[model samples]
Target: MKAVTIRTFGGPEGLAVIDVPVPAPAAGQVLIRNEAIGVGGVDAVIRRGTLAMYGFEEGHIPGSEVAGTVTAVGDGVDASWVGRRVWAFTGVGGGYVEHAIAAVEEVFPLPADLSAVDAVTLGSSGMVAHFGLAHAHFAPGESVLVRGAGGSLGIMTVQLAAHGGAGAVAVTTSSAERGDRLRKLGATHVLDRSGQGGGADAPAGYDVIIDIIAGADMPSFFAKLNPNGRMVAVGAVGGRPPADFGMAMMAAFQKSMSFATFSAATVSEPDRRAVRTAQFDAASRGELRTVVHELLPLEQAALAHRKMDAGEVFGRIVLTP
Candidate 1:
């Protein structure tokens, strides 16, 4: 089996492609013949040593999302799933390989109409978006502001919120060119993070604010919330945390607002299952679309990482093995 492994944490150059023995599924596990893999921001963070303490040891594989076919089922698992197509979140790292092993519980049957590339791209990002929106208790006709709206998860957030009958606002630093793409994805309003209209005026205070980019603008975002508004934060791509928590707190108190953070580790099994079910249901109904920005060969994984690190990607990047 071929896989990408990093012996030292650094840049994309640190990721080395090599041949390794195919892993056999142990008890409660299943071995998948990977057809597609998803490259994510967290993988870049791990590669750069920013998230090194998260239990990813040296010589570790770095992919978390995969869409493949089950080639082998371990003890206690049904043999009927042997030839079934599946998508999974391998909590640790192993999805980059030709064949990866995962616990049976982590895998879900893929929809027949969805391709492996799309299924892989929807793995972690789509699930997190679903979880965050659900935690916010989103209601129809509510208003939502999604920061980092040009990214993969952000795009999913916009589409899902709109599909649920919420007014969606997308915020991104990308030029008008990319903002148009977000608008087409269902954003009622597109705010350029680099312009004056970005945070200058709070248009019709948002009922839910999904903050994927938590940086200097967080206080402003909090202030824009209506009474009883909820803010669900999932990612921090701005390279730093908010430096003005006092202001944020004051705004929250005045507006009777609530803030919640999402950690994939803290998501319960039931919640995870619900997300998977919702994603597939939506996809089958054409309410959900996995916008793939690029498709790279598995060997070009390093290039995919570089694109993500530079923040040049508009949507999920999938790797074909």
Candidate 2:
């Protein structure tokens, strides 16, 4: 077996491919021959050793998701799982390889029409976007905004909000080309990445704000939300933004709006699976889509990480093994 390992933590170059013995599945786990892998901004963060504050050690793999065929199942696992095409969340690492192990419970059987590339890229993004928006709900005909709506998560948020009955969908992005795509994806208005409504016509303003870039522009966005509205911060792709408690509280007071942050870990296992299933079905029907920038080979995993970290990636980047 071959796997990309991070023997040292510093930059993307640290991701080196090496030969290793095929790992056998432990009890309640399954071994998969990976067909594709999912790469996102968080992978870069981990690569840069940001998570080391909590003790992330070196020699760990960097992939979080993989789509492949199960070659073997461990004790207490169903033998029928063998040879099933599926995608599994290989939590925290251990996915940048030809074959990886995943807990049996994490594996999801794929639909016949779904390709491994699509499952690991767009399919995973849809599930994440669904889970992120689960933090707050907007009523039908309500105004909605997807802040920093240029990345994979942002793209999904914009599409789902529009398809789910948002009367007005607004988005913010740095790329003009991406802005145009967002409009086509269901956005009624597209604002510049730093713009806070400005001359744009907003109907009662944004009733719900799905923010991925909670940088210095946050306070300005907070001011745009309608009274009693909610703003959910789901990402910080623009590096860590300094949060001044007093300033945020003042903004909240001005509009009587609520603010929260969501993570997949906050949701129960059953709820997560339900959301993943619904989003996957929606994607298969062509209702939800991912803006895949490229599908590179597993050997170029480091290059994918570089692009993602540089903000050059617009959507999901899949790596095939």
Best prediction by TM-score: 2
TM-score for each of the candidates: 0.91, 0.93
Evaluate model 1: give its TM-score: 0.91
Off by over 4 Å in 2: 196-199
Candidate 1 residues lying further than 4 Å off, grouped into runs, are 194-204, 215-217, 240-247
Clashing residue pair totals per candidate (backbone < 3 A)? 0, 0
lDDT of each: 0.81, 0.80
Cα error, residue 317 of model 1, in Å, equals: 0.5
Model 2 misses residue 183 by how many Å?
Answer: 1.5
Residue-level lDDT tens digits of model 1 in 30-69 = 9999999988877777787766666777688989889889
How well does model 2 score by local distance difference test? 0.80
lDDT of 2 at 240: 56
Q: Write the per-residue lDDT of candidate 2 for residues 146-210, one digit (tens) a residue.
A: 88887888888888888788888888877677778888988888788775442446554678898
